[model samples]
Target chain A: MLHELQSGFMAAVLTGSQTELTSVTPKIREGKLNTAQRVAIYRRNVQSTLRGALGDIFPTTRWMLGDDKFLNVGDQFILHAPSTSGDLNQFGRSFPEFLSAMQPSAAADMAALDWAWHEAFHAAEQAALDLSRLGAVPAEQHAALVFQLHPSARLIGSAYPLLELWQAHQNSEEAPLEISKILPADHHFLAVHRDDANVTLTPLSAPQFHFLKICAEHQPLGEAAEAAFALDANFALQAFLIQTVQQNIVIDFNEPS
Target chain B: MSPHHQSSRPPHALDPLCAGIGLRPPHYQALLGKPAAVGFLEIHSENFFGAGGPPRRYLDKFREDYAISAHGVGLSLGSADRLNPAHLENLKKLIDWLQPSLVSDHLCWVGVNGRYLNDLLPIPYTEESLKHVASHIRQTQDYLSRQMLVENVSSYLEFADSTIPEWDFLREVAQQTGCGILLDVNNIYVNSINHGFDAMQYLDAMQGADIGEIHLAGFQDTGEILIDTHGAAVSDAVWALYASAINRFGAIPTLIEWDTDIPTLDVLLAEAEKANVMLEQASFAMPTREGRRHAT
Candidate 1:
């Protein structure tokens, strides 16, 4: 009975369906406010709280779409895809995909990048790669070693220059770059990660991005390097490896199984 | 009643007489490196639920200077559905790492049927709901190997099928589960106005109850009803009620909670200072008992 009551109440608040309200309204007491008004308060609370959470997580996307449009989309998203986790941080993972489905735009790409930054911000802290361990491994056997990115590291590919867009919105003193001025690119690869306190977004070249992507798939160093070389003949694997390690991107490694 | 296991790490004890403030992210930098004026800092447990990030990193730094209270918002302990195991695991991990002086969540449910509404929704006051919530609390206390305090939530509506008073329901839940009560004085005042109940009666019911901590927050009077917004200062009426609570319950650890429209750290400390004044007055007016009481 409690389950039925809660299910009916949740359904009414989330969807505002007449049938669900019929099950819940009779069980709610009416005072200064009528039963419909009382239930409406909950409906407003549920909508605003979840909408506020999305706005917090995707402020840039909200800004891009403006308040009215963003609120509308957020409400629709809340109705269509209610949160599944008690943790609010775990909510809104699929907003980008939802936005893309509703209407593809630069805002959806920005949402993807925003989600990545969010994930990186909360991702697990891991130790940097042990230089000594790598040093002891024979140079001839280095090709067979499979490297892993930091747990906080996320590789995001988008058609828009998301980092610039995010940076532009961050500085309030300067006017935000007009979305109309920016054009879609062939591809934009970025590595979003948290190194200590800062969550940094690093732009990556086609070759470097593919190399890291391959490495993430648990490919051996030799194979990853070959893929990068395929993307560009002069791909600098040694330099990129040094930079990756220095930036705390590639955190651990294991011998290929 | 269930027995609680010893904490893996020794937790920093909060001075129960001194008032504390909620640790919001905006104040993280300003409160850092400075000696906190409050006795402890209360954090929403779900905020630090992330594996490792700025939230945990900052809490680690602040832990050195202030006692910590892990006030969770996402447990949905009163839901008819089963307790979220992942949520419990994450909460346990945070507790183990922080070793907070106090742990608390609401008596309200935030979700049902695996779909989280993410707001503190009210549950009916009845025998069945009481038993369900008590069992959930027992399960939680068992899993974490530590006793937890359950707070009363501010509600806009009351169920018609309710048999027990909200105060009685809360007290019975505490009695049944051997848990402490995180008495939100503001919620009592707000609900009193919203539901047309005597505020003094609510406090009277809580007399001799396991009142672990007191929360003082602001509310919005929307002409028709008072909403527990926690976005402003401690209202004059709520402050008066808090004084009465201290008189009745003695000097419990009180916290100033301001979630929305968060002001400067100095402003929050000022609010904490106000609660501290009441707590101090209570200590002097009455013979103070040992503030710390084990739930079991």
Candidate 2:
């Protein structure tokens, strides 16, 4: 009865197909409304509830899609994804992935950035690696020292300027997003991280993203710098390391741990 | 840490005599600037389930000055596919960290077979179903290592196959599991209008020692049936029932829940004030309603 009752209602609500309602429809009394109307109430609630979740998680995506298309995309996603968590915040983890196929232009880029922000918001807190802590280490150990990114660190790359698009949503002075104005080759490497205290998204050059990404992968300082230099021989590893530590992106480091 | 809790945070006591309002995001700035003149604060537990951030920060700040109640919106306790271990783990983590005065979720299941609806779906009130839900409640209590309350959800429709009334199902769950009842007065009123059951009878059936917390929230009248929106002011009918519920249960800890379309903090405080006044009136208005044993 549990499988029969829940699956039927879920199918009816998620797909708007009445075929599955046969098992539970007769159980509902039609005093003021018929079976369809009664089920319609739940149908509407489920849609609005799930759609509202996606809206909260991806406000930038909502700004891009407006009310109608965002909802339509959400409706289709809800049917396929079927939020597995009881937590509403955890419902749309796969929505950004689903947006890749969305019509009226896919929001894959913006959704990716928003998903990064969403994850960073809930990521665990850890103390940032202090440069002074590294100062005590012998200069010879610098390359072997493994600098780690914060637990919430995420490096997102996009062909479109998603960081710009997402940042534009925050400013009151910027013109409303015109997707048409967005160029495909506007390559962006955005560093999204939640330090123990704050969450931020900052643009980085390709070399910078790769360097930090390699460092985030637990690569030693030397290897990470070499990888960044591979993109461009003149990559400023010292300046990048100083700025990252200041931003608390490069938190703790270990000596061959 | 004790088996009842996994975290090292100490337990905080909640004053059952004081009525509080749901602390929402809209009210955070004001409340954080200066703690509101209310008894305590109530928040949707899931809202603070995040690992860290402003929700985490604000909740910690609020806990400094006020007692907190974690009213969970998810959990889907009655889901036939067994209690979600992840959801339970998150909840226990929160309880361990926050050490809230009280914790509660719904009597209805949110999803089944591993797919969550995220909405409180109605469950059939039958002997078999009753046993199923009760077992989940018992399991939850054991895992959480403390007694928690189960709330009665507002449903627009009822199943014809239900052999028992919702009130009986709720009461039986309390009796069988020893979990407290968070009797939602507005839900009873809304359910009465929608399903044509007597709200007072629902209230009367809930007169027990297990009745611990009371929730008062607004609902929308959808022309055909009432919807528990919790976005408006508590209706006159629900207040009247609160008066009755107070006489029946006696000055239980009441919470004003405003989830959506949240008005200003003043409006919410005013609603809390109203509940406080009714609570005051109930203290002296009528004799103790018999058969109502409150778990102090």
Candidate 3:
């Protein structure tokens, strides 16, 4: 009996249809509000709540889709991408991917960037290893030095210049954003991370992205720099190292661990 | 390591006799420099479950000043599906760090079958559900190594086969499982208005010994039904019900929860001040069932 009520009720909620509610209908009391209206409240709550969550977590997506379109997209995302976790923050991890397939508005690209920001906002805090400490290491060890990305840092690659697109949309003083008109036609690489709880999205050169990606993969510095050099002959290993260390991108490096 | 991880025990005990207000972000910056005169602070468990960042930092600092209660909207304590071990683990990790005075979630299920509905969906008031929910509570309490108070959810619909009343099911869950209650007065009032039950009777029905906390919030009337939006000030009827609840249960830790359209901390503290006044002005402020338990 419990199984019937639960499955039936859940079906009604997910489908927004009353077909399966017959068995559960008798249990509802005859009150000022009828059974369907009562069930409709739950259905609406589920939609509105999840939609509200997606909007909060992925505001850039909402902005791209506009209010109604985002909600419409949100509903479809709901039907296809069921929230698997109890945390509302954890609800929309798949939304960006879902949007990527659902619409052509490039909302998915923005969603992905937005999601990265959200994750970086919550990622663990780790103090980047001191550059002077690395410099203190013997020059011979420089090749073996493997830099670790800050725990809060994430690298994202996009066909669209998501960081610029995101910036333009964020500019309240700028004219109302039209993605096609303003977004530069270029592939973009960026890193998202939190410094003192301020989540930032900083653009990265292809060489920088490769270097960091390889290092983040736990490769030795020799190999990581080689990967960067492959991407750009003028990878500027010395200067990049200084910039990354100051940015706290490379934290607590050690021998192969 | 996270600053919270540095602590082995909570800074202090949550005084279960004062008023608290929900802590949201808009008021976070102001509270940092000049916190309101709130008796304690309450927060949704998931809000702080982030790996580590500013939210954690603020909460770590806030814990030093006031007792904290980890009120959870997730955990889906009554889901038919096995309780999410990951959810429990995250909460356990948080408890280890925050060491809140009390830990609680709704006496409702939010998800099932690997699909998280994310809203507190009503559970049927039946023996089968009672057993399921009780077993889940036992598992949670055992795993958490602490008591968990479950609050009732305001519902829009009722089950026809429900032989037991909501008040009875809630009381039975506490009685059988040895758990505590976080009686939400606004939920009671909202349910009373929607389901045609006497709010006073609902309060009178709860065993005083079982109630560990009291929740006060506002509701929205969409002309047809009252929704527990938690976006407004406590309605007059809810205040009246709370007064009745105070009479039956005596002074307990009451929280003024405003989730959406959150006002200034001044506004939140004002609502909490009202609850504090009720706590002080209670004619039945004498120790009831719970007070005796504490005494002996």
Q: Report, for every candidate in turn, its global Cα lDDT versus the true structure.
A: 0.87, 0.81, 0.83
For candidate 1, lDDT tens digit of each residue in B18-48?
8899998898778885675789999999988
TM-score of each: 0.95, 0.94, 0.94
Residues B1-296 of candidate 3 have per-residue lDDT tens digits of 45636577644655555689888999888787865378788989998888688888889888888889999988888788889998999998888888898899999988888788889988888899999999999999999999999999999888777889999999999998999999999999999988988877777678888888999999999987899999999999899988888866677889999988999888988898888777766634665544422231
- Could you tell me which 10 consecutive residues in candidate 1 chain A have the lowest summed lDDT? A172-181
Best by lDDT: 1
Q: If ranked by lDDT, best first, what sequence of candidates would result?
A: 1, 3, 2
lDDT of 2 at B258: 90
Q: List CA RMSD, all candidates.
A: 3.8, 3.3, 2.5
Indicate which candidate wins on TM-score.
Answer: 1
**Residues A36-105, candidate 3, lDDT per residue (tens digit)?**
8888888888988888888899977777667888888788888888789898889888888787676534
Query: Which pairs clash in the backbone of model 2?
Result: A129-A251, B4-B145, B209-B293
Worst 10 residues of 2 chain A by lDDT: A99-108
DockQ of each: 0.57, 0.55, 0.66
